[model samples]
Target: MVNIPRLPTATQAPQRPKRTDKQRKAEQAAAPVSQPTVVAKAVAETIKDPAFIEEVQARVQYDSPQGKNKQALSAYLDVLHQAKREEYSHLLGVDFYV
Candidate 1:
């Protein structure tokens, strides 16, 4: 009778190195962060412009529903306008509430 060599089992498979907490943390820290959204940039630009508010005021009737929506948007733009350029500058990079 002929005898054949046995194949390697799972127990004999090569093992990979386990990552340390420091290495894991380093990898996480090295990851790139997300940038600001398009809406935020547009809001920032609108905040810098005075004519935008005037244009909204000119086109919308204060009593109508559509006008109310415009008013709300205009008010929010006003808030962004009144906010300190230095203090809220970081918020300009965000899409919504900062």
Candidate 2:
């Protein structure tokens, strides 16, 4: 039998340092501190606004016989139910269906 040359085994090479510890520490220190901004404060106020919530509820509840017969309301409800079921299933690992 003729002698066969041996192939080199695959191996991982040493990785180079991407960033130094001082650089990482400086970046961490320079990171933006979490504080509520004007937009965030406005959002919180809007959420707590009773009139806004009431208006939204009124719009959701205001349904005509024609709209109900056309399954528009039912379709919206079904979509909401499906989304909630999916969220619950992801959290609890249970089969959720409407």
Best by TM-score: 2
Query: Per-residue lDDT of 43-76 in model 1, one digit per residue for the tens?
Result: 9999889998889879986554476788898788
**lDDT tens digits, residue span 9-41, model 2:** 566899987998999999999999999999999
Instruction: Quote the RMSD, in angstroms, for model 2.
Output: 12.5
Against the true structure, whose lDDT is highest? 2
Q: Looking at model 1, how many pairs of residues clash?
A: 0
Clashing pairs in 1: none
What is the alpha-carbon lDDT for the whole of candidate 1? 0.76
Q: Model 2 residue 14 lDDT? A: 94
RMSD of each: 21.4, 12.5
Cα-based TM-score, every candidate: 0.29, 0.35
